[model samples]
Target: MLSVESLSKSYGKKEIFKDISFSVQPGNIIGLVGENGAGKSTLLSILATLQSPEKGSIALFELDYKSKKREVRKHIAFVPQDIALWEDLTVEENMMFFEKLSWKKKGKEELKQLCSNVKLDRWNERVKTLSGGMKRKLNLAVSLIHDPELLLLDEPTAGIDLKSRKEIGNYLKKLALENGKMIIYTSHDMDEITNLCDQIICIGEDPFYQEILTETGKNILSF
Candidate 1:
């Protein structure tokens, strides 16, 4: 489980968010939704342990963020809004490079399987030569090399075709239900969010609200 309490951040005198709190369970996908400049990306960065919050605390499976940052990172993977890959490298090459960088490296065959899981079959194709959808798929595949328990994605399917978006959405469901991976994703697509997430955390909205949705219905609570 992931727990966040009283989280807050600020840049100089401008405050981003404050007193934010939420928890994520295994086998659940939490959609972090908000309008532009709502600190969605900034919050993800803090959860990824790449940035520090001015207040509050975060923990994963009871491991405190301040005291066990490295351990926390090991169990989570962060995929940013921007693609993080070498455009010049082939699909297979990119997989191998990321694998080698992981603390738990896998064999070439295993690395290839990771890509296969995401349906990225263009092994020899350079990232620069692949379509936007294919590139997005490869980006996701690369992040699975370490097999983290949690995935943090920021607009992962943004600017992609419907087919690609559907494929990514389906795979994320598989990861959560079949593999028990916790996910926190951000997207502007309401249909995708409604279909993909088990709950919604809305930040930076007036009279702050967090809506928890299930198959039955949705409940809105003001914070």
Candidate 2:
């Protein structure tokens, strides 16, 4: 559903990555791996259309991102590394806010169902009162509120308990396998990559250091 070709990005004097190319299809769970400062999030930011690449093209559903910004955005949802909910808002309030922002206001029942799928059970609890894991799920729930076809997650599982991690992982897998959502996510933990992704892309200091994980996610080798 997404295609990127010859993508290049750099800072003033330092090059992050260049000549990068990849495509993601519906029902594909792509894991992005890289060392800190290796530009994983930067790459994701470009894919989310929050930033522009110096060179190359990004297309979503055959629509050129450069020219069809609004069309592509309608199909993409990005969950950043930081929590994006008001700490004082109750669960219902938080979902409602995002739903309205999506320009598609779903009913409370629909919103509650989204929270339930993310394993967030407290509808009346304030955001600050929820556990770290619940917060993560709530973040995800907010992203799904729009029902976008492409989901980009940066450290979605970070700082959550193990159970929550696995739960979130399984739900993501379900999104790909059953809901036919295309997912691109990043994590420091290799195991999360192994457990959730159908393919893995690794970035490193060497510009040529690109590898795709096996379908089982058991191994990574050059394409």
Candidate 3:
């Protein structure tokens, strides 16, 4: 489980979010929605342990972010808004590079399977040669190289075609339901949000922080 309580952050005199709280259970696909300056990316960055929160606490699987930063990171993966890859490298090379950086290394077969999961079969094709959607898919595949339990994505489907978007959405759903991985992603597509997310967390601009269940007759949590 993921527990966030009274979370707050600020930049100098500017406050981003204050007293934000929520919890996510296993196998839940959460959609984080807000305006441009709503701090969606900021929140994800904090959760990913890339930045420290000025106040509040975050715990994943009972591990506190402050005291167990390294351990927590082992089970967490963050896919940033911008694709992080070596454009000059091939698909397999990129995967190998990220795998080497991970704490837990995966075998060649395992790495190949990860690529297959995203349908990225062009092992020798350079990242620069792949299309936008393929690159996004490859980005996701690389993030999963460590087999993290929690996945954080930022506009993963942005600039992708309908088919590619659907493929990525399907793969995410599979990972959550079949693999029991927790997913939190930020997106502007309502249709995608409605179709992929089990719950929606609205932040920034919105006076009341809320978590709305996408499923009918489900309970809604608001603060």
Candidate 4:
């Protein structure tokens, strides 16, 4: 399980998060939702270990992110808000580079299988030549190549076509259901949150809310 306790951050005098707490179990999909500048990205960054919070801590399973940064990172994969890939590199080359950096070697068949699973089979094209949706797909493929236990996505479906959104959503759902990987995604799209997440954590300053939604109904709270 992933646990966040009283996570707080500040930029000079401006406070981003005051005291946030949440937990995500295996096979759970959590949505981080808020308006712009509501600290959604900051919170995700803290959870991803890209940055540290001024107060509080995060734990994946039994590993503490603060003390076991490297170990924690190995179990988590973060897809940033922007597409961070080498535009000059071919799609397959990008994936291969990331796979190698992950220090995990797979047979040729497994590598091909990973590409097919992410629907990047025809990825010989350069990343710069691919469409926005295709680039996002490749980004997700690279993040999952190491098979991290937790996947953190920051507005991954933003600015993509509807078809791509659905495809990515389905793939993430499959990973959680079939592979038992935990997923935490952040987005401002209410429909995406409603459809893809089992629980929603709403963050803001004046008013904050957190809700857990199931097929039947929702449990809501205000903070």
Q: Per-residue error at 81 for model 4, in Å?
A: 1.5
Model 1 alpha-carbon drift over 4 Å, by segment: 206-216, 219-223
Candidate 3's displacement at residue 65, Å, is 0.4
RMSD of each: 2.4, 2.6, 2.5, 2.6
Model 4 C-alpha lDDT versus the unseen true structure: 0.82
Candidate 3 lDDT at 150 equals: 96
Give the lowest summed-lDDT range of ten residues in model 3.
209-218
The TM-score that candidate 3 achieves is 0.92
Best by lDDT: 3
TM-score of each: 0.93, 0.93, 0.92, 0.92
lDDT, candidate 3, 84-105, per-residue tens = 9999999989999999998887
Model 4, position 121: C-alpha lDDT score: 66
lDDT of 3 at 213: 34
Query: How do the residues 139-209 of candidate 4 rate in per-residue lDDT, one tens digit apiece?
Result: 88888777899999999999998988888899899999999999998987777888888877777743423
What is the lDDT for 191 in model 2? Answer: 73
TM-score-best of 1 and 4? 1
Model 4 pairs whose backbones collide: none
Sort by TM-score, best first: what order?
Answer: 1, 2, 3, 4
